[model samples]
Target: MDDAGIYTRESEYLDCYVQLGLASDRVLAVSFPEESDDEDADHALLDRIDAYLEGEREEFDDVAVALTVPTDQREVLETTREVPYGEQVSVERLTRMTPGLDASSDEDHDAVRTALAANPAPLVIPDHRVRDGPSGAPPEIEQRLRALEGL
Candidate 1:
């Protein structure tokens, strides 16, 4: 994590060839690197992630993250990040939460899906909490995250 915030993350839950950025921020390019080094990881964030996974009811709003996506997707992800632990909200509900979005429109739903699919920080944003669609994480990982939250 830089002084700005977390810009990218890789996890076992994320599939092979998952989006990886070569730059420090803004994801200048996407590629599958030959190796992953965890030596320089932010221990504090790792500890929070571990604690949350351990059913400690951790909330990540305090942690800073850098989202390099477009404005619309950024809004959707920001709203998703506010979903409280142990609670799930539908994509429709998420669309409704954002201004200028019509929840009933399929286009809006697709936008929500697209935004979630491009999520830069999955667990911290808690995309799994936005139900009825992909959470950017794999299905099994989403299930595990939900179960951790006692859903």
Candidate 2:
């Protein structure tokens, strides 16, 4: 069953590669359109996400989301928000992006990976921009997003 207050969206440009669900103003799930089993949704939030996917805009900072993430994970995810379109950063590099994070520890490095794996907002935060990083979108979707960026 769908979570209460969640909405579904499919990309017009890369509808095959991207479909997303939202809950409480935040992205809840992301997948290939073919893989999504979501009800029809035409909320403003979905339109904003689709607009971003189509390259008509940049930055979802105004979208306003409420995520239930740990302080460390939230910091990593927030840093990803600065990753410009068509750019990619490695997980190891992302680990250091967070302030005061100990880059020398193996555990600290893995924490970035773990945080990414639990990302609640994918395209909005653009998790695909992280090289070889965890993605809420499918492989094809990630590829499609990159392709749109002409990468």
Give the clashing residue pairs of candidate 2, or none: none
Q: Summing lDDT over every window of 10 consecutive residues in candidate 2, give the lowest-scoring window.
A: 1-10
* Residue 41 C-alpha lDDT in model 1: 47
lDDT of 1 at 11: 42
* Model 2: residue 139 alpha-carbon error in angstroms: 1.7
Model 1 lDDT tens row, 1-151:
5333322334443333223332343323232232455333454455566566656887678765567789999899888988899899998999998777899999999999999988876777788887686776666777878877877
Best by lDDT: 2
lDDT of 2 at 129: 85
* Full-model lDDT for every candidate: 0.68, 0.71
Residue 73 in candidate 1, Cα distance off native in Å: 0.3
RMSD of each: 4.8, 3.6
Task: Give the Cα error of residue 96 in candidate 2, in Å.
Answer: 1.4
In terms of lDDT, model 1 sits at 0.68
